[model samples]
Target: MSEVVTRTERPAQRPVHRPVFLTRRRTYLWAAGAVLLLALPFYLDRFWLQAGLFAMAAAIGATGLNLLTGATGQLSMGHAFFLAVGAYGYCVFAGDGADGLTGLGLPTWLAAVLAVLVAGVAGGVFSPIAGRLRGAYLGIATLALIFIGQHVLFNARDLTGGYNGRDVPPLSLFGLTFDDRELVVAAVPFGSAEKLWYAGLVLLLAGGLFARGVLRGRPGRAMNAIRDHRVAAGVIGVPVARYRAAVFVLSSMYAGLAGVLLALVFQRTVPEYFGMTLSLDYLAMIVIGGLGSVSGAAIGAAFVSLLPQILTRYSDLLPLVSAPGTGGIAPGEAARYLYGAAVVAVVLFLPGGLVRITARRNRPTPQEDT
Candidate 1:
């Protein structure tokens, strides 16, 4: 007799519909953070506010650099040069041709926009080189930008105020001035640092969101493809050179915005601050935070930028750190050493950087049943 086989039918499973945006826990965390940020200016002093502002600016710059070097695999060593361009560009656009400086005396808002554009133009000018070169070659070529920028910043006194630098005109938006002039709000005196704190927050939020969108969109996919294999990406019809150049311009604009915020925070643009060291610091930030990650860049920026400030604040309690000129390792130097070691350690151990640590902690481990 012939044997008959029966087919067993399985029950259909419904697709799980998870929320695309924030979950309840994340929303609560975000709300808490916002409340804290809103209240910080009232409680924190100028020093802490200034330090936070610096971290915000660094985060913006690092995010841009991450887009280029980290996500796109394009080596860039001229990030600080773009920052200098933005800082001085803002001065030129906003200055009233006073103090023997050349300026257009544009509106503060217009000046800020123009400064960002100027940085984009500067990057475009270098795009040919950026588009053609890759890896260490591109990095070496970009290194020239720092030297050239330094020379211009020092010698072009009319434009950049030379070695002594120039004062940054206060930013005015909707009649509110981000200046040292105190504006009382909720019984708290809001000075330049305090006012700029809000401005910095706005800028950082916008910049981070925009960069995240870019990273999560079609452009991001193309960039990743080019990063993973340039030849294969090109064969698949990706415009390798154009994408590289465009990313360079975009990255420069981000740096430019950061420079403007930094100038506002410092109230002065010092040529010495935007040097090779600054560029290296940006590189270290991306490496330590996590390459190809927006949150990683921001996290790295805060860590690196805040380390020196934290060390200085508690130098007496720390053995290896001391105030500047105290003979011991200066806080800045100590920060550098710590981050340098972190960079090496991350590369050797966690190739994904510090972001992976958080990821690992959040990941659930599989359980084995006996």
Candidate 2:
């Protein structure tokens, strides 16, 4: 088509490097896992099912915080505060309000939704400190929030029910009350645990998928970039502070969601439950499960959530080692000691977390490939 002796222009092309690991095979596996989760409550017993429900909640919270700390390099020691906000928020909005200042008397579901938003706003309020701080300094700032939150929780008598803790109304889904185990699953016997288990499973899966989306998407890349080199990322026009603040707030929202689920499971909302210990436990869950990995978060959540109960059942099986001050090996003391040791053992050997251990079994090594 070009005229004789006419010069032809060439289209410019750039080399594209696509990651081979992300294939259709991986997506299918993920889908299967999600499907399995949905069907879990159908088969499991009440205790296991309830444990699973709580584990998923913890896993969701851990996954979000992991994104902030492990993926985005931001530390938060006040996560329990956000969780407490969620728990109490549900209680406040849904409870009878013995004093009656302003109770929404809203439906449990709607109240829960409002509670999650309140938690997000609470996080947003602390965004500036989180945005400005880093490392131990950030931890200190967040720790202060947890303490301050506890103080406010105690002082806000009209709102928080003052130390005694307010009762959480049983959740109802579409004219069905969840409290009456008999009503949880009308047609099926042994359905309440299974029903709640299924509910927890769905929320967790949704949370996991959401986490996966954020981690694998642009924001995830940006978070990783900031985590690796903040100044460099900033130089490249990434809004580092904005992302940090946003993530902290987002993480808090995740924590709040977990709290809502927690209240649902316990059927009670006690501010004391969301304390420093719980914050530590959540951090431990991520570490033991695998930081920055959704699979790890779930795996870790199951482990930490179930460990206490499992160990408590088997405490008598272990050699009784009485403490220096204790007469008989106190169940509480034994549990604490065992828990500390468990954390130590996991950190010492499984530093990469339980996921790496699980994955290594299936993934071929270079030697195997050769």
Candidate 3:
């Protein structure tokens, strides 16, 4: 006999669309942030403005490093090498050449572009190493870059000004010298602080946007594929070597851009600044901020750069700390201990880094709804 007729009704489904109010809320938040940034220089002193600039620079550098180590699954412990290339590159092209080695006398803007390009070349040269290397070996290979960069800086006496280091020329835009700490900008009463704030904001925006673009588009897919399995990606017709090298090169360029801004803000380029410690510090930031995430890198940069100031300010209050050249544990020493502990805690507890922590908190649990 045929089966008896017994039919079940299917449930209707609704298409998923984001709430309009949610979009509006995000838009409003972004507008508010922009307004706050624009008004910051007016209310802040030069010191505050400078701090903001430094934070932005570090964020940019961290963003690039994050792309390589976090996203591309490559471990690079020598990103500072690229930063050094950028700073020295700018100093060479725009600095006053007392010894006549560099000082091409090019416009600061042009010099900045060239510096970024040179940094890209440096990355390209290192790309093969990244493509062929992995794990501890990759870290060691990249580490060599720091020493190599330092040697070049020290020995390029004609260009780098040896030992003492050389001064960075003030950045000029269409005739306006961005160097003036006292100068005010248009529509802002406190011009100098405003100008610097705006400059930093612009660069940060550019860097963030570029990173977002890379991670959201086709290149991002390639990066993820290679990161997941280089051999498998190659088998599937992915240009693993080319993509790896390109990421390395692009990441280096980002580091260079960061270096150019850093030199401009500090008004000097010293070979000693781009040491192995700087590279390690950046790695710490990536670890603390969250690997493979741009937002995490930014948060990491702020923490790494700003924590020292807070620690120094409060070191006197701590029982084990004292000022340098006067008595107990040096202020710097105490700060280092604090930073080291923080790093250890972060790694031991949150291996995925700060991004995951934030994500976890933001996610809605059944308990949360209740």
User: What's the number of clashes in each of the models?
Assistant: 0, 0, 3
Could you arrange the candidates by TM-score from highest to lowest? 1, 3, 2
lDDT of 1 by residue, 1-370 (tens): 9977798788997554434332455678789998999889999999999999999999999999999999999999999999998999999999998778898999999999999999999999999999999999999999999999999999998898888999999999999988889999888999999999998999999999999999999999999999999999999999999999999999999999999999998889999999999999999999999999998999899989999999989999999788888789998899999999999999999899899987665444433110
lDDT of 1: 0.93
lDDT of 3 by residue, 257-319 (tens): 999989988887888999998898888888889888888898888888777666566777878
Tens digit per residue, CA lDDT, model 2, 142-191: 99988888887877877776676666777777876667456433445645
User: Which residue ranges in model 2 land beyond 4 Å of their true spot?
Assistant: 1-44, 98-102, 184-187, 190-192, 316-318, 321-339, 342-348, 365-370
Give candidates' CA RMSD values in order.
3.3, 6.4, 3.2
> How close is every model to the real structure, measured as TM-score?
0.93, 0.83, 0.89
In angstroms, give how far residue 176 of model 3 lies from its true place: 2.3
Number of the top-ranking candidate, with lDDT as the measure:
1
lDDT of each structure? Answer: 0.93, 0.80, 0.83
TM-score of 1: 0.93
